[model samples]
Target: MTALHSSAVTDGDGDGDGDDNGRRRELRVATLVAACCLALVAVAFVPAPVGAGDNIASFWFNPEDTEAAAGDTLELELVASTHGDLVGDGVDELAATLEYNSEIFTVTAIEHERMLADGDSAVEIHEHEEIDEDSGAVTIEQEREPSGDGARTTGPMATVTFEVASDAPSGNETIEITDAEAILISDYPQGTFDRDAHVQIDGSAAAGASDADGVPGFTGIAALGVLAALALAAVVKRRD
Candidate 1:
């Protein structure tokens, strides 16, 4: 009887120790999983370093793409955005050359936007614009007078009006910004930039005018369909 009692106590103690070890292992695994999850969440919420994100200031074209017919007039704005942060505490001066296909487009005029003024009534702006159709280029240079007078904002740097050539062929063309330079009020040069405006032309109207006088503009496929419709009507009439 004594031996059985001792064996029973020993077995109970062993079972209790095994249960305690199992519980400890489970708790350790749960804690590790919770810590891993927290680390992942913290990493996800961290912000990206500067110059690696969209927070940087830049320039681009408004209406990045457009469609028009031959002889149509289109306007494109040179857009500048400071993104409310560094690299563009607002630009005090801008200079860029716009390049296009002279055979497809002609520059009609250029108008500067009051980006430099930025609602500061004390600042005056001096602007210069030039267009060379033969070279298919337009140049714009604008600066705030009494240089470095700040205008911390974003807006159009300029608006360019273009006339599609009367005989421009159908397809897509592009206008690009080049030799670009931007200056901040602090005399700091800006290097961030974006460019290019795509223009899609519908030359079917021009083709129809040349193919048939006083006829409505029609694509080749449309003209063929009409011819097929006429032939079907004639065949039905003959059959009747």
Candidate 2:
């Protein structure tokens, strides 16, 4: 009877151990599942870097080469582009000025173009002018404020018509954007304009639409972010 009792005790201990091990395994599995869920949530909600692009922006007059007879009227475009991505989201305001030779040309008119960004709905604009004759500087300031909804990344900024002076010099001259003493007003704490953006640009004989080259590997990353969200959703559905 003692031997039988001992056998029974041994069996009971073995059974208890088996049960405990089973519970541990179940707990480990639960922990793993929970970790995976948290990963998915993070993937779905985490915001990607605001601009996965070069963040490079250029504002310049189009048709870099433009020419006309003295005293003739000349029309030109001022365009702004974000090389790879749309403008940053935090930006709510923008202001830029074009500085040129007041002795060579006189400002005739300034007009707003389509939205600067591709999908932007509304951008309020303010056009201001200052002509310094003694210094031979003509400043045309264009201010843009995005609506609460947001602004697009790139597009035509304005149309500037100039009346050339009858006695203007007969040679190519610059229609420059202010960057040194005066600056390009852009938000994100108002970044200064790049000389590189306009480095290749020059006022030409018949100004044709042109663009400054954008640095590669700096394209907008909106697509990557969207993919991350979609991957998270797929993982969640697979869990079921």
Candidate 3:
């Protein structure tokens, strides 16, 4: 009877050890799965490259119009409708023509190239130079040519970016795109330049205007906030 009891105790010990091992394996798997899920979620939050049908030709300034004292700098953005192939070569080639109160200012172009694989967008600034009024006809040209390597067979698309100093002649200023040009891919949809033109003034420029804090324009920020909340919730659930 003593030997039988000893054997029963040994069997129970073995069963408990097996159960512990099973539980440990399950926990490890769950942890690994959770890690992979987190990695995927991180990738999802990354901005995707602009693809076909993405509007790259048109550009606009946020708040469209604003009022500022002379010498005040307004941060403007050149937003592409799509993250199209044209970004590979560069975005600096695009030009901006600012006309205020008949005084024209041409800003030197700056380009920020983004790699599609990395999901990064580039920014180009046209700030260094300002063109004064031109009595002769001023030709605003966009000399965008694809690399002959055929890598850009789909053609490239991008927008011009620049800032406008409130140096207007202290009066109601009217800004308009005197002209624009772009390279087009025969097969792809050719984006219209007409949408790329506009002007803005301070406090009372247009019906729809927002401050630089991006208050009224919260689309991008709102999306990111929602995604962050979801991720936080996932982490809490996993910990529990």
Candidate 4:
């Protein structure tokens, strides 16, 4: 009778041990799945660092031109396709133009305030250079600092903005802007304008179209898509 009772107790202990091991295995698998899901979520939501190929070949001094007027504040907003702190390094050149009387009017300005998209900090370039031209093409070169803080920092993306006078030429003139000889240090592709990117004159507010054979405008949709894909991956991983 004692021997039989002892066998029964041993069997109960073995069963409990097996149950505990099974529970532990399940817990570990669950933890791994949760971690993978979280990683995917982070990747989906996090915006990638902008690169040189993503740079805008051209943008309007006044996109909508809602308030373009002679003697008025001609607000020139540069809509660069690429936006990041690292853009500063890849920028090889910069140019701006205002068309008038069948001729193009180009201006030169200094790039200032290397601010981030989040507007948290400003970067300083080691070298600031500009092209010397009144019309046609202009080039700029600068040495940009790398990203991150302290030692072992990564490269920074080139970022720049220009401020031009609103006193544009009149009488059938078109204000054209182009980024001349803009080089990218990254492995991605680079581009330039052929005839130049133009904004119509005659005090009319309209969006400028790309030149016949020029690089198309950069949109934020690609980045958004990447994020979405990452999110989907995370979801699938968790489900698995």
Candidate 5:
């Protein structure tokens, strides 16, 4: 027969006092075990998004790519569209580093959208730095209105402007943003997402090189010059 450890019976001092104490200990243990089981059952019934792993929000840009000519300026906007339950601690701050092809564009300026400040009673701080040592990169940081009494968790956050280099050549270049972090007013940090941007260079010298001729502009002109010089040389040779 297997030994029984159940609280059904126990050897006490053969006195009622010892029996009562042993019974009390067994009752407490049973209560604790029952309470743990109930708690676990409650958690198991929780619904979508609230499911432990799916609770999260994200931040990204709209119109991830842009087309502009040399000397032209363009804007990129950032937005937050929560994916799961649309539940979040509400965003309070954002800090990021943006980079681009220095030879193709220059960081002109940036500003926070008013949408991020609609009901915030606290003052918002907006700051940005152009990394002069690295002409192709800029660092931006913004502290939105504080959480309580009206904080925003979504919508346009900011606009970054880039001026195409006056001498930029044709083709595509990447506008990279890194170390991006969005902090909620509740002090929680959003940890998962991706953001990207690309610039398509056109016009200016690139235009002078493509739109001028039925053929590729610059190459056609160079080819014509060479053929003309050859024809001239042939005429001179025949006369000799």
Candidate 6:
């Protein structure tokens, strides 16, 4: 009877130990799950970085949105911004192409701005401007002659003069930067962004409104559809 009792006591102790081990394993699993959840939540609250680099250079028209009358002449300033920090390099060269409705407007002239010169006339700037009337495209290229450290400022790269057609109808027209690129003083390619400009012509009668299909130019509704589709495609592509 004594030996039997001793065996039963040992079995009881073994069962107790097994139960304690199971409870410890459960606690460890719970702790690990909680830690993972907290880490995910913290990441969700963090803001996304704008760009990989310290500086995010961008190009856009001075007056992003403006109005012009038929037969009017206006100047559009193509501005570049280099959000340069202590560690970021500056812009030394730039190239861009502007697209517009050929029938509605014409490119008269284009001149370089002082931004590339760093506001110093002693700094020479080489500029080239070409107008393609057939396609309504204006190509602009500018470089600092002696691109040392580059200009770390924001200002106009070129001032484009446009002549509105005599009989342009009242509507919204988009001036888009189809292509653009920039180079830093380090000779490495710099990240850049471009924005489109909008010009609203105020006139009751249509001046040069006709597409190749022999129909009227893009109405506000048509333009909105195209713009929305383009924006959506861009977003989707970037996401991919």
Name the best candidate (by TM-score).
Answer: 6
Lowest summed lDDT window (length 10), candidate 1: 4-13
Q: What is the TM-score of each candidate against the true structure?
A: 0.60, 0.48, 0.32, 0.33, 0.57, 0.65
Q: Model 1 clash pairs?
A: none
Q: Whose lDDT is greatest here?
A: 6
- Candidate that beats the other on lDDT, 2 or 4, i.e. the better one: 2
Clashes of each: 0, 11, 13, 12, 0, 2
Candidate 2 weakest lDDT stretch, 10 residues: 194-203
Could you tell me which 10 consecutive residues in candidate 3 have the lowest summed lDDT?
A: 147-156
Alpha-carbon runs more than 4 Å astray in model 4: 1-73, 83-122, 126-143, 147-170, 179-189, 192-240
Native-referenced Cα lDDT, model 2: 0.56
- Residue range 39-133, candidate 5, lDDT tens digits: 99888987545332234445567768878888888888866543322353455566667777777777677776654464664556555555642
**Between the candidate structures 1 and 4, which one is better when assessed by TM-score?**
1
lDDT of each: 0.78, 0.56, 0.42, 0.41, 0.66, 0.81
Clashes in model 5: which pairs? none
Question: Over the stretch 131-180, how does candidate 4's per-residue lDDT look in tens digits?
Answer: 44544344333433443331111122232223223344333433345443
lDDT of 1 by residue, 85-201 (tens): 254455677788899999988999898888777758577889999889899999999888766545666789899999988887688999998877667666666666777899899
Q: Rank the candidates by lDDT, best first.
A: 6, 1, 5, 2, 3, 4
- Candidate 3 lDDT by residue in tens digits, 75-160: 43433332334444223233345444433233434333221112222322222324454431222334223312111222222223
Candidate 2 off by > 4 Å: 1-54, 83-90, 114-123, 138-146, 180-187, 190-240
Better of 2 and 6 by TM-score: 6
